[model samples]
Target: MSTRILISGASIAGPALAHWLGRYGFEVTVVELAPALRDGGQDVDFRGRTHLTVLERMGVLDELRALGTGGSPMTFVAADGRRMLHLPAEFAGGDVEVPRGELAQLLYRHSSARAEYVFGDSITALEETPSGVRVAFRYAAPREFDLVIGADGLHSNVRRLAFGPEERYVRHLGYYAATWRLPNDPGLPVGSVGLNVPGRLMSVGASHRDPGRAGAFALFASPELRYDRHDQAQQKALVRAAFAGLGWRVPQVLDSLDAAPELYFDSISRADVPAWSSGRIALVGDAACGATIGGMGTGTGVVAAYVLAGELARARGDHRAAFEGYERLLRGYAQGCQKGGDRTGPFLAPRTATGLRFRNAVLNRRWALDKMLELGKEVSSVELPHYEAELSGMAGREG
Candidate 1:
């Protein structure tokens, strides 16, 4: 019988892994906590050849290119609306940029035919038996699978259940970020424009698809905050307090918070697990090695999924060998890509006037900006083996 694999999380990494595993003839099943797919998020990009290579292997590279957002330039302004510094699109957009929600959907569609997806459910418990894993779900009856993997985000339930509490793994990086939709002002430009004060930033950009709508994004430096992840009202209050005395359209953006239908808020953090797997269970993507933002996390997630699935195919039924190989080949490379997250908070919202001035002055130089861009490509580069098992979907893939 083919191996029965259970994956938790229907986001990018989960679906991407399912696609490759299914193509390898594994019986793949994915469970997602959300009722359905999520949509309408900030732009996410892929950098370097490693990221592009995985997308090409999945056969979704052209599709993602069609959905690409031409990259958005950021303009930082003073309290009174005078532009201080401008960063071109490539700085943040990388090689190709797409909305976060859009990428999630594309991955889901690519894997749905090959994998069974159970939505609006979650894994409550897992037990490894002699030959497989006994899994319990919130809404479905208990079932067993040959292997289990967690592709959930940093706050992964699977990791918490298999590993210890989240405190042991997730470390806050002294910053918080939030985003929500707002009414378009019509006067707003194509990309992001924001007011920056010491330790805070309030930015907005009109939607590329719908000119009548806009997105509000804010970043602030804080030690560490405690709050309910599901409570939007409390999150809104925290954001309002963080920017209370700020000038330049601050009130206008805050006023829209009450009317915004959805809000995405979280601390800037990273997850570091000493071991990637235990017994019949393993982890991938943010659940394994991830940074909250500016970590090339999205790109890293897909690449890690590709390598994880390929390693399994190479090992066939020997999961221990597969997991060890996956970590061996990818850990150093993943950590190298993840280091960028450590600089995100200070870069977006400097803690002091001197730091802010230095950032603006230094990044203003074209040579400095070019040098930084070159480094991103360098860190994300990695060589990968072509897994072309006979009858595998990736068989006969173009070089």
Candidate 2:
């Protein structure tokens, strides 16, 4: 029988991994906590040759290229509406940027026909037996799988269950970020215009496709605070408290939250797991090694999915060798990519006004912007082993 693989989380990593695993002849199943495919997330991007290569191999490169939202420009302004710093769309838009939601859908489409996808459900327990791993779900009958992978995000349930508590793996970097939708204020200009106060940033941009609605992305420096991840009211209260008494349309944006159905609020954080696997269960993407935001996570996750699936296919039934090879190949590159998350908080919402000014001043120069972009590429670089031969073998059998 073909290897049966169950992957948790239906976001970027899980779906992408499903595509590769299906291509390599694995019986794949994916479970997502969300009832439906999530939509309306911030634009995520992939950088450098390494990211592009994996995308091309997955055969979704052209589709993503077509869906690309060009590097959306962002302007930082004073409370009085004077532009302090203007960053070109390309500056933040890596090589290819698309709405995170759209990318997730595209991947799901590619693998849905071949893989069993259970929405609004999640894994509750895992037990490895001599035959396979016994798995229990929140609302489904228990089943056994040959292997399990956690592609969930930073707060991975599988990681917590398999590895340990989240405290041992995730490190908060003195900042919190929140984003939500609001009615587009015709009085204000379009595109992202942010107000940068000491330790706080509030930005809003109207959707290019839907001028009637806009999205607000906020960042603020803060020490770690305890909060329930699943409680929206508490999360909204935390955001309201964090950005209380802000000027320049912040109140209006916050007011809109009353009607907002969903909000993404979390501390900026990174995850570091000493190992990526435990017996029959393993981890991929952010669950294994992630730097929350601005850490090339989208690209790194895609690369890791490709490598992990390829390694497993190459190893046949020997999951131990496959898991080892996968971790060995990705750990250094993933850590290199993660370092960017450390700087993201300080860069976005500097603790002091002076720090904010310095960031603006340094980035204002053309050379400096170019240098930083170049450095971003270096961090994303990794040598990918050619798996085309393995793919060719699969095709030969089909022919």
Candidate 3:
């Protein structure tokens, strides 16, 4: 009998996992909390061969390349709007860059035919039985599946229910980041333009699709503030307080906050779960290992999904063996990738003025900038197994 798998969160990781599970002939169902597929998030990039290979295997590489953002070059300016430093588009865009929303939509479209997706709902509880997992939803009737996986994200409900409270695994990385859209006003350039004042970075860039619309990206150093994630007004207020006295279009960006339709705000945090799975429930992607901004999280999540689903198929539905192999193969690579996230916030907005200046001075040099880019490529490197061979062999035997 085909293994019935229930996955939480229909974002990148969830749908990616569903695609592989369905290919392997497993019954897959994905539940997402959002009413619909989210739209308009920060541009995410896939760097190095490892990331590209996975996308190629999934048959989305060509499409993603076509949709890629040409690049988002950044120019850091002084208070008076004089450019102080510049970083090329390749520095941030990597090999392939696409708005997160577009990628999510693509993944959803790819997996929808095979995987049952329940949007506008979420898993409220999980109960593991000897044979399977019983899941309770916020709206839908309860159901049972052979296994459950959490691809939800950093603050995953599955992780919270299966493992423990969020605090036990989620670590605040001393910063907060927020993004929103505003009118591109004639002043903002085509690419990113920003001003940094010790501990805070406020920037605005033209939206890749719509030239008339601009996007705001900001980060500020903070120990960890208490706020409701659902409260957009409160989050905007916090952002305002952080950049209160800033200059160079910051006031205008702040003014747009009230009128902005949506905002993405959260503490720059990382999750380090000791074990990726317990019993019939498991965690993948951000729920297991995630870094908020700096972490090559998007690529890592996609890679992890492939491995987890492939391992499950290899194990022939023996979840104990599948889960163990998945962790053994991926734990090291995921952790190494997560290390980059630790430096993301500090690199974007240094906590001290001297630190900020040093970053700009060093990155201003071509050699230093090249070295940093090279290091990023190196971090993304991972040895992936050809799971297709194993699955094909299994099919041959069955035939």
Candidate 4:
């Protein structure tokens, strides 16, 4: 008999995992906390090597390419409100940009037919026996599955119950970031504008094939601030406090904060887990190692899903073997992305005014930017292995 797997979260990681798990012949069920498919947020790019490979294998590479945002150019503005230098869109985002929810929708479409999904609910508790795991949902009857995977985000309920406390695994990078969509203003242009004031950044860019709407990100350097991730009021107050004294159009941006519907605010953080799996329970994506919120996080999630589901198929439903194989194959990749996140924080938000000036100088100098791009090419390059099992019929297990 095929193993039955319950996956939490239907975002990028969960649905991607479901695609491979279902093909590998496991019965897959995904549960998401969102009432329906979330359809908003800033576009994400699938750059680096491994992420592209994952998309190709899933047969969504063409769709992703078609949906890419190539028209949005970016400009870095000085505190004095002058365009310092114009940068290609790839500078702030990546090689390509697609909305976060677009990626989620693409993943869901690929996996939906073969996998079952339960929306508007979430896992509340997980109790594992020698043979399998018994899961309790917030509003549904308990059910048993051979394996349970948490593709949930940083504050994963499954991770807390199966592993330990979140604080033990999450490391904050001393910064807070918020992203949301707002109405396009006549005052702003169609391209992106990045405003910087040493350890702070505010920007808005054209959002996913849409001209009348734009996505904005506000980031600032700060120590960890205590607030409920689910508390909208608390989050709003925090954003207001962070940018209270800023001048010019900054006030206008802050005013839009309270009214935006799809606001996503969280600490710039990474998850560091010693081991990603325990018995019949495991974690993937941000629940395992988010590697921060740039291009790398998206890529890491895609690659992890491929490697994990591939291992499960190879092990023929042996949870231990599959889990170990998954770790061995993907740990190095995760480490590389994590290192990029660590380096990026200092580069993106320099501590001192002098340091910020130095960074801007680097960006302004063509040779320095070229050198950095060369270094990035070296770090992002990886030899990906095509899972013969997935390409062929061997990986698909009949559920």
User: Which candidate do you rate higher for TM-score, 3 or 4?
Assistant: 3
Model 4 regions more than 4 Å off: 380-385, 388-399
- Rank list by TM-score: 3, 2, 1, 4
TM-score of each: 0.95, 0.96, 0.97, 0.94
What TM-score does model 4 achieve against the real structure? Answer: 0.94
| Model 3 alpha-carbon drift over 4 Å, by segment | none
Measured by TM-score, the strongest candidate is: 3
lDDT string, candidate 3, 299-344, tens digits: 9999999999989888888899999999999999899889988988
The total number of steric clashes, by the backbone 3 Å criterion, in model 1 comes to 0
How far off is model 4, as Cα RMSD? 2.5
Scored by lDDT, the top model is 3
Q: Candidate 1 or 4, higher lDDT?
A: 1
Tell how far residue 189 is off in model 2, in angstroms: 4.9
TM-score of 1: 0.95
Compared with the true structure, what per-residue lDDT tens digits does model 1 show for residues 1-399? 328999999888999999999888899999999899877567899988899998998899999999988888999999999988999887788889998888999999889999999999999999989989999999999999999999999999999998879999999999999999898975687779999999999999987777888899999999898899989999999999999988998889989999988899999999999999998899999999989898888999899999988888888758999999999999988998889999998998999999999999998898998897777567557788887643254445642
Q: What TM-score does structure 2 among the candidates reach? A: 0.96
Collision pairs in model 1:
none
The predicted structure with the larger lDDT, 3 or 4, is: 3
Of candidates 2 and 1, the better by lDDT: 1
lDDT of each: 0.89, 0.88, 0.90, 0.80
Candidate 3, residue 264: Cα displacement in angstroms equals: 0.8
> Ten residues in a row with the worst lDDT in model 3?
373-382
